[model samples]
Target: MTRESEALSLRVRRVLHAPRAVVFRALIDPDELARWWGPEGFTIPGVERDLRPGGSFRITMRPPDGEAFHLVGEYRLVEPPERLSYTFRWEEPDPEDRETVVDLALRDLPGVGCELHLEQGSFATPSRLALHEEGWSQSLDKLDRLLTAEGRA
Candidate 1:
């Protein structure tokens, strides 16, 4: 088994028109993931999800430059529509470091919308944190578009 590692995380607020359950389902459901899985222009060619603990959730992200980054990780915690904490490690990380933890949470806002929060911690340096901040921010924007397109918002 791979060792537990650290990552720098961020907390974000996303108001989706759908209920917390619906938003959470979109995140955990593999079939629904393809629609909004990458940062802005990047594409997701493959995705595999396991909804239970110890299951593997893997995705292949294809950037516009044709670079493919395979994100392979295991599910550490899973509570539908409420919380999900996972171990996110790149398949081909820099030889020096190879792992990080990403924790995601969902909260219902009583007829308003769902709040999606994320915490990605344990990064070794501030640069890595900054890099991920950009990536996740872009990805969240894409998710907004996807949810809107799906008529969930």
Candidate 2:
């Protein structure tokens, strides 16, 4: 859920059914990210990554019934299993959209799994922030399921 929100920022925190290191790997690894990185009904067909500070990354997301979307980002920081920071922008950005920063943090939770803390934005408006909130909520739900079912796949 969104931890807090202001005119220019959004924060959300979620606990996943995996360890911090495992969740971190899923976020940084292209193959694993492809499994659960978009809104519900959307699938990521490809990802190219250079997971180091200042490195670039690209991912193509295909919705079941819409045109594909391309997202490009540059890593701002890579702190292994604990934190990641990046800049996010769409290749075909909306007229009102601009590059935004996203910071992801993972904290170990002993026997309860791992905590994912996501803080993103400076969205052009509250509506835009709402859109991101919906998207990320669905995507994170997918991530939870993917991690829980990892042993089966």
Candidate 3:
């Protein structure tokens, strides 16, 4: 199914076969994150998340290229089982490498499904936005598979 949300930002829509609360918890819980946080080939080494406004997150990962990268961000908004917004950046101290805002929202559907819609905005340039869009799409595809498996077991 197509998940569409137009809100002046980059968007991604995925229909998950789980309740909104369950899916939202996976987004907020660090333990659940390590299971499926990145793309198919990446692995998370550390995950620290505080799921409230003014709270932050730190995650470290190793790519297939054997290089380690870190994502550190602060939660800007949190509306439980509904919406989450945050500021994202690479772990580097350099200001030029920091990314913009990422917003994740969950909408409960009529039946036993939930639609996850993500918005990534405030990119420094078009090239950066494009790369983020592709990367997030791939990551969410992995997340879809992961959540589906989790729901089964």
Best by TM-score: 2
Q: Write the per-residue lDDT of candidate 2 for residues 123-145, one digit (tens) a residue.
A: 87777788898989999999999
Which pairs clash inside model 2? Answer: none
What lDDT would each prediction earn against the true structure? 0.78, 0.89, 0.77
* 1-153: candidate 1 lDDT, tens digit per residue: 223333344456677667788788878887677777777788888898876899998899998898888999999999987998888888888653447777888888887778888887667666777777888888777777777777775
What CA root-mean-square deviation does each model show from the true structure?
3.7, 3.2, 4.8
Better of 2 and 3 by TM-score: 2
| TM-score of candidate 2 versus the correct structure, residues matched by position | 0.93
**Candidate that scores best on lDDT:** 2
TM-score of each: 0.87, 0.93, 0.84
Q: Once model 1 is optimally superposed onto the true structure by TM-score, how far is the C-alpha of residue 152 displaced, in angstroms?
A: 1.4
Model 3: lDDT to the true structure: 0.77
**Residue 90 of model 3: what lDDT?**
86
Worst 10 residues of 3 by lDDT: 1-10
